[model samples]
Target: MRVISFINMKGGVGKTTLSTNVAHCLAVHEKKKVLLIDIDPQFNATQCFFSGDDYVKYMEDGSDTVLDLFDGDVTRVSTVRGASHKSKKCYEEIKPYKIMDNLYILPGNLNLFKIEISAGSGKENRLKKYLDVVQQLLGFDYVIIDTPPTPSIWMTSALVASNYYVIPVKPDPLSYTGVSLLQTIIDQKKEDLDLQLKFLGIILTMVEESTLVYKRCVETIKSTDNLKDYLFGNFIHKRTEIPKQQLSQSFILDLEKSELSYNLVAIIKEMIKRIERYEEHK
Candidate 1:
């Protein structure tokens, strides 16, 4: 299975939005079997699918959540939890739903923070180990992991487990810093592990097309020969409605209603196709 992760050192760059929508678009629109693994403690992705009551029942009360896997020896199959009725039922009801025939989700909770604190040092491989179990226990064509914004053990673990990393950067000075921070860490990790990780590309998020600042930043990013290597041709435009829709749990029924959604969907489809081509060539 292909394991991919979406990450950025800075928050509010639409990382979660992109990750969630990409997984949904691939599964629902492309008819691909996808599994989304939420590694962020905020559980924003979890909230996108599950309600509080459902969380209490399926995640809090004796049932397994993502935290349980990292906190213990995840070699056993029992550490992972199955999709809950609430999540399943919700997916069934959402209009213009794009959850593909074989898509699944592993929810996250607030407790993930503590798990990171306890994991310490070499346990960063916990995510990789548990993913091995998941592959053996529940096979899927792809695994998409959504990580937290800040640098942390859990985030690093997710990177270590991924075959490719997609970075979302906003067009601003601080945005460049965030991208640089992650790139530095990724390079360090590559050297430390002596592993080769293909950088999928950087998606510019929350950009306003009319703004000179945005235009200037884009030019600057493109003008740098080395930075050019990090950018994806597809840049995500800033859209107020997208996040609002996500917050309201709106479904993408028709792409005609929102150009942003349409373009985002197109970018995601392009990414999937690119990855597939790479794998085929390999």
Candidate 2:
């Protein structure tokens, strides 16, 4: 499976929105089996898939979540021993919720914040190890992980487990700073973990073309060598319909023909091409 993470060092840059919409587009339009893993403790991505009442029910029932994979009781064993190993056991235990025909989500929990604090040093590799089993059993075409805004064990684990990552940057100076910080973090993790993680691209979200700040940011991105090469050609413009549809629990693909839907479709196409290029080079 192609594992990708939508990440940013700053919050409210539309990370969850981008991740959810991309997964929806892949599953609904491309006929690909997509698995969305909500690693963010905020559980915003999980909320996107469920209603308020349903979310409460899911939390109250102690349904299987990402927390189950991180708990101390879950241990990993070699797959060479066949189907009776710990990996398969854990995989069977955590049942991902099916949202659509080809879309599933490994829900997130609020308790993840607490679990992350007390987590051991070995926790960084836990997500990677668990996904190994998941790819074998579930066989998804794409796995998109949504991470917290700030750097933490969860973010590190997500990066360690992903084949590629996309940074969702808002059209602002501060968001540019976040891009720099995230780039450094990714570089450090790649060297530390000996990972072959590729930079898919930086997507500009919530863009307002009329604003001077937006123009300046775009100019800077074009002028800067490092940022220019990695910035996606298509940007997501701010639209009221996005939040309206999200509040109504509507998928991007299900929305009426509008600018938001068009942008989402374009972004997903670009993402697919980038992934294909990475696979080719690899």
Each prediction's RMSD to truth: 6.8, 6.3
**Taking the tens digit of each residue's C-alpha lDDT, what string does model 1 give over 111-208?**
67655363346767766877776677666677888999877777878888888888888888787655666788888878877655777777888888
- Misplaced by over 4 Å in model 1 are 73-100, 116-121, 251-257, 276-282
Each model's lDDT comes to: 0.71, 0.84
| Backbone clashes, each candidate | 3, 0
Candidate 2: tens digits of C-alpha lDDT, residues 1-282? 999999998998989988998998899988999999999999999888999889878765656788877775434232333322123236556778899899999999876876644334786787888788877788899999999998888988899999999999899999876677678888988888788999999999999989999899888877877678888888888888778878877876786687777878888889889889878876
lDDT score of residue 6 within candidate 2: 93
- Which residue pairs of candidate 1 clash? 27-100, 28-98, 28-100
TM-score per prediction, in order, is: 0.82, 0.91
lDDT of 2: 0.84
